[model samples]
Target: MSRPRSYDEPSVLSGAMQAFRRDGYRGVSIRDLEDATGLKAGSIYNSFGDKAGLFDAAFEHYNKVVLGGRVDRFAPAAAGISGLRDLFISLMHEPNGESHGCLITNSAIELDRDEQTYRHVCTGMDILFEVFLNRLAAAQQDGSLRAGTDPVLAATKLLALYQGLLVLVRAGRDTQALERLVAAEFHELETYHDARPAQQDIQA
Candidate 1:
């Protein structure tokens, strides 16, 4: 019979999650995880089954606690562009005070081997796209967007924008520069001006 664990599962996973964020999948070794989680190899193997299992747990934890948590803030913001701005600003902050980069985004670049991980990331992105697409449609209805602007296209652009920004942050771009870049994109959208003037018929 196996004895109950002395270590907390979530705590161990949370600590390993931080190490994964900092070292990345390929960069981190079994020894690295051991150091981060304070669990011996046998315990890790017995508790989580393997490194892959441990990583899968950690990835889900990061999504819910770090990345997905940002979406909860959307309800309070004005929605559409204002809510999007708040979301973008939140991305600049690191998860658990580790500025390495998004665990999902980082893992995304190395997802050639793991089907389960890839599916999770893909589903997460699709959920994000659906949420933003609806928000963009709402903005159009409220006249915050151009009368003829395509909500689908705008939402896709936003998806690209945030993902690209994460890579830039990982590349060590200056914080001021990152903020300025965000400001420039928002300024180009002219969101500060009153909702786009209604379109008028030009027929004679």
Candidate 2:
């Protein structure tokens, strides 16, 4: 049999993911991976094949561990719209220093020419949009959102707002300003749904 594996696969992959997240795939060198993972060149080559292979594994790890958790926050709830609102608010409230914007967004910027990488990033984005769409549809069906509000359009707009917030956060905006912008976006969403209660209805 071949030599037994000596390294901690999960921990090494986790380190590789963070390194790739902080520096784009193109920027991360074999040396970087080796240094971050504590895996020598030979071990990395034998276990992961090459830089592209390591990146593919690392990207998947990042998606599952980092990005995947965020999209799940939009799960259907008593107040679907409110759930979506809270998800966005939490995202914007995340300490600015802790965010690297978004891993997929960063990958899109750096790996525009690589079809495989581009497709992977697009697929992740599609999943996020679909999650928002489901929440918006539930809100519409429950009458919490106004009739005639297209779920697809509303979802798209919400996703755009989220992506824009990521960009703003990456640009070094303060948390207070991000919170204000997030609140404004929520107000805009309510206005779009024409969701104001009448004065008479409130009194009753």
Candidate 3:
């Protein structure tokens, strides 16, 4: 019978993720992973196949465990505008040391030439955009957003703003500045409501 796995896969993967997040894929070596994960070369190879394989595993873990929780916070917001606002606020409030911008956005910048890695990153971005689009559509239907607002366009703009904020935060932008920037964008959403009649506002 095949031998059962001997090490703590989740723990090892979490360490690997930290290493990968600190250094892009090309920068992480087997020795680095070995030190980070406390797994010998042979053990890592045996379990995960190669460095790329281990990175893929770590990326998946980070996505589900870290980014996933933040995204989940917006899932219950009453409308797209609220959800988008909440999402930006969460990013601004992210703990100092834990703020590394975004793993997927970093991957996108570092792995653009690698088709497999690019595709994986693109899929994650697509899911985020789709979620925003769906929420925006719901807002439009309920009159919380203007009737003529293009859900896809609004989603794209929000995504750009969010990703840009991530870049700014990673560069050491002040937390208050980030908060103000996000609040300003959210305030613009109110203009749409202002154009609607008072009765429509009550229905929203």
Q: How accurate is candidate 3 locally (lDDT)?
A: 0.78
Model 1: residues with Cα > 4 Å off, grouped in runs: 74-78, 95-98, 188-204
When 1 and 3 are scored with lDDT, the better candidate is: 3
Writing each residue's lDDT as its tens digit, candidate 3 over 1-204 gives 988977898899988988887787887899999999999999999999989899889888877777666677775446457767888888777666676457787888888656665666776678678777877778877777765678888889888887788788777788788898888877765346454568977798
Scored against the true structure, residue 142 in model 3 reaches a CA lDDT of: 78
Predicted structure 3, TM vs. truth: 0.83
**Please, what is the TM-score per model?**
0.81, 0.82, 0.83
lDDT of each: 0.76, 0.76, 0.78
Write model 2 residue lDDT over 1-204, tens digit each, in one string: 988898898899988887887777878888998899999988999988888788878777767766666655544455477767777777666564666556777887788656665666887788779878887777777666656778899889887887887777777778678888777766665545555789999899
**For model 1, how does the per-residue alpha-carbon lDDT over 23-134 read when each residue is reduced to its tens digit?**
8887888999999899998999988899988898888887777666677675233666777777777777666546866776787787674577776577667767776787
RMSD to true structure for each model, in Å: 5.8, 4.6, 5.5
